[model samples]
Target: MPHNPISNVQHDVMHSLYMNHHNWLYTWIRRRLDNQFDAADLTQDTFLRIHAKQNVDLINEPKAYLATIAKGLVSHFYRRKSLEQTYLEYLAKQPENLAPSTENQFIILQTLEAIDALLNTLPGHVKEVFLMSQLEGKKYQQIADEMTLSLATVKRYMKQAYVHCFVLMENDFFE
Candidate 1:
């Protein structure tokens, strides 16, 4: 017997899910995740879960489906945050190279969170461009030539990355 219409839809959805929606899904995941690694991992997990489903349809409301996936990702984030806090508390109780003052610890955590939030908002390449220029201290022309992107494109991407990080910072993460 041939596959039913729902099965056919499921096949189609599975085939195209990652390919067609990768960027959108990444953006969605990033909004809720702290950093590039977490965002990338969760985005990959979202697709993996979809793939693992026995059968699913081409969802009439892909946006809604995507939102549901994001919620799960957020829950994962909270769980991770709790574990990290526990690890940090344990580390505090251990002998260390240096003890962190409460203010310094707060600053470090805020910086990490800000970095995570910024990374989530940025596109992969844009984030790369910004990192290459800022973290590596490369010139814009150098970044453009290295990435084989146009100078204007590199500048635009950097500008977008800056705006994203700036907005996150302005939210008073440092305060």
Candidate 2:
């Protein structure tokens, strides 16, 4: 079967992209991380993501493409770190006998991370309302009163949030 240049030369294109952009990407992430070791690791991770995602068979703006992917990796790294710290603080607050065992703690932490990732994509107000109602166990009226939003507005926000989450589930965001 014959294919166009785009499909035929994908490997060459990817190699060229890697050669041209990998060093710059590494330096960029390194500067942000302020630690050479972590920077190197994340740089490799960035490329791995591109390869796995197959987003680099064509490179129009190599630097911009690499930077965007690397930036996402950096953001995820920070988000995961914050989730870890929050989880540790939660464990600390629990009485010693009541806290989960070490293995269970890891499971709970991963669960929290998955939930956080799901919520992170929602709009600010939608996310706030969702969290207040779900995590804080607040009533819709209480949420409306606390945020100075009308009851109707609160209902709309909750509906929007729930719909967004349902869509994500349908689209396999959980996977």
Candidate 3:
């Protein structure tokens, strides 16, 4: 079978891209994530995403595309970091600190796992609003405006969501 010249060029470009920058991708992610294991995972995920997209001819610069994918990984990492920080701040206010003991890092990890589960249980709009307000530092009125909802509706949603999150934390039950 004869391959078209354009197809051959694309294949050569993609192959060279894979060869030249693959190892550097992990370093790029590790710099942002500060964890080699997670960096390897993210680097693999980046290439997997590029492969899944099959965007050979469309991307003018392969390095730029890799950088964009790495940036996305960084953004996701920071988003989770912010979520964990918010959860920790919430936990700090509780009367009981379950992870207070020196060897109770396991307990803290478990508590964070439960909080993550509970966060997923929230309604879409409510969750977005909560994230905007608490994580992104948006004001209530700002969230209402951004969501195109009445201020009272925003307030009600936030209150209900907060109460649910608080109760879940208080009970130490995520289900």
**TM values, all candidates:** 0.44, 0.82, 0.47
- Candidate 3 residues 132-159, lDDT tens each? 9987999999998999999998899899
Model 1 spans > 4 angstroms off: 1-11, 95-175
Error of 3 at 51 (Å): 0.9
State model 3's lDDT.
Answer: 0.79
lDDT of each: 0.77, 0.86, 0.79
Per-residue accuracy of model 2 over 90-119 as CA lDDT, tens digit each:
889989999989899888878777788889
Clashing residue pair totals per candidate (backbone < 3 A): 1, 0, 0
User: Per-candidate RMSD vs. true structure?
Assistant: 13.1, 3.2, 9.3
Q: Model 3: how far is 53 from its true place, Å? A: 0.8
| C-alpha lDDT of residue 74 in model 1 | 76
TM match of model 3 to true structure: 0.47
Worst 10 residues of 2 by lDDT: 50-59
Per-residue lDDT, model 3, residue 17, is: 75
Q: What is the lDDT for 135 in model 1?
A: 76
Model 2 misplaced regions, further than 4 Å: 1-8, 55-57, 170-172
Provide the lDDT at 9 for model 3: 72
